[model samples]
Target: MHRVKSDLLSAHIGSKPSKTWRAICDGIDVLKQGLIKRIGDGATTLIWACNWIPRTGIFRPIASKVPEPPVLVSELIDHTSMTWKAELVRNCFFDFDSDVILQIPLSMRKQEDFWAWHHETNGLFTVCSAYRMLVETKKNREDYFGSCGNCSDVQRIQKEWKHLWRMKMPSKIKVFCWRLAHNSLPTGSVLKNKNLANTANCKICGAEEDTWIHSLLQCNISKCVWALMDEDLLDLLASLRFSDPKYWVSYICCNIPQADGIRILVTCWAIWYARRKAIHEGIFKSPFSIMIMINRLIEEFEFVQGIDFKEKDLYQEKSRTHNWIAPQNGLSKINTDAAIDRTGTKGVVAAVCRNDQGGFIAASAMVIPHITDPETLEAMACLEALAFAEDCGIRSFVVALDCLNVVKNIREMP
Candidate 1:
């Protein structure tokens, strides 16, 4: 049986009279040798015997299809050389009629030919069919993979996929690049690369070199602003013995006590605002001006929250020393004033106790705002004075107010 199988197999392989058939026979011989190595001599012989083929089927297909056989068939022959190539084309031609390859019409025979050639050359037909099966499994997620607008629009999802593949981005930067590409960041509008012509020099300093990082921090003008801010902040930080920016920010935020976090935020925001003004508006102001602007911004932020920095600092100092008190005679002179400005609107209430020489012994100011009515403002002022007195360890003190309505309100209180 083994001898008969080998004779029949050789005859069938040789009778085909084609290079493809010869190559297939060579592959089978290699496979048989591999099987012999694994399964031993008798098992290999049995395998060959079970796998033999007749010569009839092999020659009939080509002989019936072609009028005459070639002298020597080439292994590098094109697809047209195959007897079944026309039948394969016909099957794919009708397959396209079923509305497959939906984007490309069936009338595009050239495109169909290119696709078939690609499949055959790259051996991707099976892989693509498997991918189609996986895609069909995700039919529920079809909406996400749909076109941007109406199906009639010329926009193709395939083009976007091809572009994305060509980008070859690292996984870490991919999402960030996607957001940037989609114009989704807060700075996205300002961060445009219009053209090579539009981006010649730094707009602020007229420097020939201009880049994102340069415009942000490294440019001469930006560096000057940062240097001045760093100097002041570094001085304050040195006094606190914190050298690093992170440590300085943390120290100021934690130790400064009142509205320190808000102050830090305002300071940073002011610095960026100044840089933007310089770049966009071409306003090259002094570093001192920027610092002043930061101070004003901080004041504005505090004012909106009904507070003042200077008065707050003084009050905190007095609160720490236990010196915000009335006179020993149970009489306190309260001076109330309101500081109203575009940046801030706050009412100040100060309690003072003078010595025999008319020098101030104890004084305190309460800074609070959002006062709509004059009477309520004065009452709040007196209350602030009394609270200061109580905080300074003074239990009994006479409260004085310039407003008669405030005086009347305090007297009428049970």
Candidate 2:
């Protein structure tokens, strides 16, 4: 039955004396049995056979039928196989294209099936080949075509260029890099050899020099600080045991609670702070001193957390002290302002008392230097005022602010 079908397709296509045509006719015979429903007329039979044969070898299906013998081998190849479709989907390899297809392979027709089969077969080689081709294509595109200047290298460049053109990089990568850059591990110098440096003497303690592993969690200094906190920084190190530095940074930042991590951050900060102080002050502080500083910071933070006072109390206390007392049962208001500049930021907190008669009794503003954000500055001002009011033994008051956000934020304070 197969032989008869082959002979019929060859006669309909042509008794072409070419190896290519003969092979194509055989393929057409196979496809015709499965694909074609009926070839009722001679011309129709020929058209049906040729359409199944891939005329151009480029995989494009021929829309126009040629009603002639010695059919263009190209037309048969184009109709049958989808080489051009494959080429287009593959983006001519990574060397030729630098962009990632935003759509998944399953979303595409031929490519979907191809990838499904490739995945089923565990064709890692083929998958890697395709990846390399894509990378090469992207490199060529960036080299010849205009490159996104911000992209430092081909690897950093993404395939979804069109989709991500307007969207900035997600905060994940930037935050990871920023955290890594800030933490220890010689920011500027590149360690030549990992194995050799891992065994080298410690730069600070005159003991074995710490490698990437030591600097992060294993070194004496780091361990000592952790021990002093009576907290297990080792658990954090264990969680990150298998991860790279970048992954470790992300894991730590994401997993640790804000408050608990603040302690860890301050501990690490104290370690580095003490190291710097030793060099600058020319007085080497013991590891105990570093631990003391960390404990002090934690205590100070705990103290602030325990305070309770209304924003109004701050205003009334200010008014009475200024010899400008407001009438009994009046509204007290507090104003917090934050100014940011390249040099630094300053937060000014002002308090005013108003009498039942709608007269201002007293007002005062004080600038707090070294504040970073307006929210923080406002919080600090309110906190300072609360402290001052409590010292003056004023129990009841109202806080007013031109900054609605600050007012809302403080009002929502738990």
Candidate 3:
């Protein structure tokens, strides 16, 4: 690791360096661009140089410049308590950076500062995160996307992308939708444009061009899937057509409820999968069968998620969980649970607090944008539950976590 930092990250390039060495050196900036400072003791990290602020754009503070004002991150820390000095933070930085800094949870144990891959929640780097980081970095290039057309006009389309990303579904389905929005799906017209195919017409509908919208949302086969899943949305968006798939998605997303949107996204993915199967595996199924499969898939996902959302009083799913036991008198009990995607890349954390008599007190839920493990999520839920309990002025409370590992770790902690 030291060699890597020295040789690849900080070393000066020589006039006679090998091609492989030069390549590694050249890629250092890209690697460094994704690395963020995970403030532990904060003694080693420069506040101006390190990517510490957890925002979408630049991680460095707008108030501070690199290597000029030489400020250590430790200056922002309250050494007595291992927490951020809130007043100092607010005084030193602008509102946006201060808010971001204060929201970053700190460990009770003050450890050494370290570099973590910003893209992953676990602070560990992965090839997948690296690839995504590269793609996002490239988006800044003017010619990378060829033409953005009108960003203002497509903001709604981008919001649909955000909503699609947040939906509780398989990551592959979300990625498929993303590619579909970018009009990069290998439909007949796209393939033809790329010179990979001779014809641009839809194989099923005989349309002039098989665009992403037509292939995934409009063809007779897709229409049948939607009619089975949601005939109203089918009719509402039946005439929806755009030269760009993004506009069609934006219109549909704006018109439908998010629940129906998930169904449509999943159905599109299934339709694409079925098309591949028909072509490659020589298998064919009726639209009803495809819809049935999609329905089952959605039901299973919702059934799992229903444990957190559907209950009127929360935790009423007797089949999945044990019966709820109220806390002792004058005390409150908090229950926390989190749901993660299939890849564990993100999670939704929820905590519900109730009085000793089982009446609700306060409840909160938040999205963990990215996560490496469910244990961390469960632990975070516990923390949020505790914080919520404190905010509600509950002096005596107990947090009930389903994660045995986190519970055991808490018990073993000194």
Predictions: Cα RMSD each: 35.7, 26.1, 9.5
**Against the hidden true structure, what lDDT does model 2 obtain?**
0.43
Sort by TM-score, top down from the best? 3, 2, 1
- State the weakest 10-residue window (summed lDDT) of model 2: 100-109
Worst 10 residues of 3 by lDDT: 307-316
**Model 3 scores what on Cα lDDT?**
0.73
lDDT of 3 at 392: 81
Q: lDDT: which is higher, 1 or 3?
A: 3
Best candidate per TM-score, number? Answer: 3
| Stretches of model 3 off by over 4 angstroms after superposition | 1-8, 64-70, 143-320, 323-414
Per-residue lDDT over 1-414 for candidate 3, one digit per residue giving the tens place of the 0 to 100 score: 213445445775566777877777777767787888887888998888778876566888888422344389888877887667777776777786776777565554547877777776556677788887778567745544677544532334455677667667778887887788788888898899999999999876789988877777778887777777545657656666576766666654555555666666778889998877775686977898998888788888778765222223221234576778998888889999988766755677899988899898889997764353567778878877877877788889888888887887677544
Question: Which of candidates 1 and 2 is the stronger one according to lDDT?
Answer: 2
lDDT of 1 by residue, 159-227 (tens): 343443333223323343333334332231233354435445666667665543344345665566556
CA-lDDT, candidates in order: 0.41, 0.43, 0.73
* Model 2 residue 208 distance off true place after TM-score fit, in angstroms: 4.7
